[model samples]
Target: MTAKPMTAAGASRASVLFPAVAAFAIGFGLIFMSGLVQAETLHDAAHDVRHATGFPCH
Candidate 1:
């Protein structure tokens, strides 16, 4: 089967715009969801890391 050539508008819109839009949407969703997650501070990570390292951060 042969592929038909795309119209000028279709080609530009598909190649340039669709991927740019999809990437922007993915980045926006990631940033938006990150705001919903609880972030740990250095002090919070210290204990976990210490225990994992067999150091016992207490």
Candidate 2:
């Protein structure tokens, strides 16, 4: 059996689709993990990020 070559349209659709699907999966995973993290832990991380970026988070 021989594998069929991908058409131009099929390749274009796949290129667009893969990123969208990956982004959605990453976003969903982050949201799910955020829910499981403690509030203080989250706040501390945010605060550290803010300070690291030179944004005063007083």
Candidate 3:
């Protein structure tokens, strides 16, 4: 049996809020509870290098 997909036609305004709240909860948990990203990723390192006072890499 196939599971039915959800859609906006059946969703209320508060349903949209659920995803935003879930995202915030995940971000908050990762930053505060897990400490998972304190070590810089490549993107973070590159971003820092880009912002280092001399040039706008735009």
Candidate 4:
């Protein structure tokens, strides 16, 4: 069987929107939660993310 070609019509709004919304929610949640905690706690949590994203933090 032959493979079908991809088209713009095959892309749904939810496919793109879901990731954006999820990321926004995660960021908002992190920010909100951090405010409720201490600096050391936030730093530890963000440290993992920074390394994962290849961001340098000292």
If ranked by lDDT, best first, what sequence of candidates would result? 4, 2, 1, 3
Highest TM-score model number: 2
> What are the models' TM-scores?
0.38, 0.39, 0.33, 0.37
**Steric overlap count per candidate:** 0, 0, 0, 0
What are the runs in model 3 whose C-alpha is more than 4 Å off? 1-12, 34-58
Q: Per-residue lDDT for 3-56 in model 4, tens only?
A: 656566675666778888999999988765544344676757777665576555
How well is each residue in 1-58 modelled by candidate 1, as lDDT tens digits? 8977778666755587888999999998764443333345533645455556554344
Cα lDDT tens digits, model 2, 1-58, are 8966878656667588989999999998785444434467675666666557555454
- Cα misplacement distance, residue 51 of candidate 2 (Å): 26
Give the runs in model 4 whose Cα sits over 4 Å from its true position. Answer: 1-12, 36-58
lDDT of 2: 0.66
Question: What does the lDDT come to for candidate 3?
Answer: 0.56
* lDDT, model 4, position 24: 97
Worst 10 residues of 4 by lDDT: 30-39
TM value for model 4: 0.37
**Candidate 2 TM-score over all chains jointly:** 0.39
Clash pairs detected, candidate 3? none
